[model samples]
Target: MNHEVIGGIPVLWADAPGPLEAVLMFGCGVQDETLRTLGTTHMVEHLAMSTLPRLHHEHNASVDLLTTQFTCTGRPEQVVAFLAAVCEALTALPLERIEQEAGVLAAEDGRVADPATAELLSHRYGVQGLGLAAYRGPGADRIPVEAVQEAVDRFFHRGNAVLVLTGPPPADLRLPLPDGERPDRSAALPVLRTGPSWREEDVPGPGLALHGDLDDPALQLACKLLSQRLRDTVRHRHGLSYDVGGDAVLAGPGHGERTLCLDAREGQEQRVAELLWEEALRLARECPTEDELAEEIAELREVYQDPRSTTCELGEAAGALLFGGTYQDPQTRLAVLEKVTPDEVRQAFAAALETVLLVVPCGTEVDPKLPDGRPLPRRACGTEGELPPGAKVFRPPLVDRLRSSDARRARLAVDGRGLWAREPDGTVHHVPFTEVVGVEMRGPGRVVFGRDTCVIPVVPELWAGIGPAVDAVDAAVPGQLRYPASAFRPAD
Candidate 1:
């Protein structure tokens, strides 16, 4: 089987294989958000699959504008069929009708929320353009569903595709046409990343959630290190948090750079902020112990060194190949991983001295100190123990008070949908597709999708007396999810 292909396209066939797993990935780099809004790349992906005339395929794809990448991963037999379909769909989606898919494209193009996500992201990216919220990391993270759907319509085009294929093709697969080529691209690739800086906001909580932004090339590696150290020093060493975790958030759809994200229990916001700064200083000045250093290096090596032993991994490799042309070959990845050293990691850590945004959300009632050593203000509760007018409330998901280490259970009836669950605290999980997983029900008749199962949870209703949005991401796993409501409505 061949691993390298000219023009970032390849074919592999093996004679000894019994049932080879075939993978094909396609990628296109995106440079601007306007193209993302145009929906050219998305239409191409959707239509490509439609053209697969004979094969049943399963794949994953995302339209990333930050790096201008559109990736498709699927089987070899279907891929050839896919490309053909895309070529046809570009001119075929009936662009002439404003009544057709064109409107969908327009709707998606209009869905942009210029919010703190970007402001916070900018802190990590520093001056680098990678932090633009319109183009990075699941561009739909906080977007409306209608807008995300529309972005899909405008991306069906010719210029935004990077065809990548890997593994041995099944013998029955055939390629009949002479290879057609897309135009070659130019140099001047913008290096991705942000220099560190701080962005902060307060959340209603007894504890502060400190999240650091990444603008460093070595951010992915830095995240693994800092999170472990911070956990040991702030959360573990002193037992401040109930739980804590740190992860590197990649910004682009294909090969975007990384940012560090983390959450910890509340109460020591001021102390935690100081610890964060001190830890950054410590990482830059004090070298890690040899044992601590070697362990992290080994972990990095495993990400690529692990053999492709399953269809899932192959599918993942295929996705990376198709979407990020930069990572088209498994061997190259393995080779790169094998060559990493400890000194390189230390060097990356030392260089990340610039302070990034430190967002800490502490419950206002906690009397926690801010980084500058100021007391937190009391967050207000709109109303207690109340339901919206004309809404029926089934009891049990809520508890007035409970001793720590206690359990409670209840069933809720909203617009005829029954949601049952247990809560360690008064927090609720935003279940997908219920009139009200927490409150509204996509019910028999919701504001939209009357009976549709795409229930959007009432965005953080009341848990105890504090608005739940403040504790949205950090709560007990919801044992129940209902397919109900489609929009956010405040609890009256």
Candidate 2:
């Protein structure tokens, strides 16, 4: 593939001389949105793609952790025209169909609820930044056209984008986008805990999930070897599990996580957990054999040797350029693979053990026999300072407040320094003002406090004089910290 710049946008093209597959990617997605504005990027994606005409090409739009892309597969000319239309649609977004598009987004969310994956991420990272998947979809009905417009203006521009063509570049390909600076990655959202944590959810059956940083190629190989061991022992040998695999979440440079997963039969919970640790502990203590490493390396080489490998690598290469990541071509990756010794894999596995987060079936009992697991805390972590004055405190059963039959009733006090929610039994949770990175209004009556630990929801109707108190809190926070409520609301 060759690299060039067109109309101030980076372009990567390969002369494959076949049907074309092209993608235009922007460095924006769910990570760029807030809890209140949760689906803004996605909404904008749908709105932009909605404007494209029906061409004889396969086209679609997707929003992932850190990038939103519109891709098309067809003849070179058709692909180019589709992309141009996509860019034009993005420039002048159609806000009139926002409500219609939101309905579609809400339906999409309902169809793909992989609780196992979502629970693992939420438990590991909390409901901020990349962890938004663990929570409900953004109140789509509450999103407004103005918010969608702002997202397009801020993130969809020439400087923050790239276009990749796998077959051939179209003649006179032009992208008339407005001038804008490349936007950096969004701020890191705060989590309840950064240390190793554990959570149990009521999933369909038993499973084990683990995640850690991508520090080295050896570490990546270790994850694969570990998954293989689990599958062999638990599935082939014992018939305990049907599926086991490992995946990498390479959002950008230095920011990546390897996830190891295993799904088991109904009564194999304990056995699966035991086998998972047995393999993981074994890998951490001893490196794989030369034969094993050679086999894995051969498989990696085969992937790159495929006829369609260059086309596959094109998108990843373009994404790496936009994300400040290291883009190793097939040859470079092979070179790196050769340098990875079995001993290095062992050491990487050992280090990964330090920051592991585990997710297990809620009702199942299993003991990997590691350190004692700490249950997720109810309040914020590391918050300090006395509560501010003019605070409005509200208890449960407040007007329009959603609650369960046995939900813990507490007093939520909002002040300048921060907000605190204390249980009736004197258990207190405080979110300091300094820790507040952003604030957002979810609805006309609901306010969310974006803190380092969690998103604290407060209902104004639940507290007296909430308007004045919130006004003061807004003054204490930065203007960019808040998002105005959208105009639309879902029907009952």
| TM-score of each prediction | 0.47, 0.80
Global lDDT of each model? 0.38, 0.69
Weakest lDDT window of 10 consecutive positions for candidate 2:
373-382
Clashes of 1: 54
By TM-score, how accurate is candidate 2? 0.80
Which sections of candidate 2 miss by over 4 Å? 15-18, 110-114, 185-194, 202-215, 267-270, 371-492
The CA lDDT at 214 in model 2 is 59
lDDT of 1 by residue, 188-222 (tens): 22432233333244432111112332323244455
lDDT string for model 2 (173-219, tens) is 88878888887643334444444544556554333344454547888
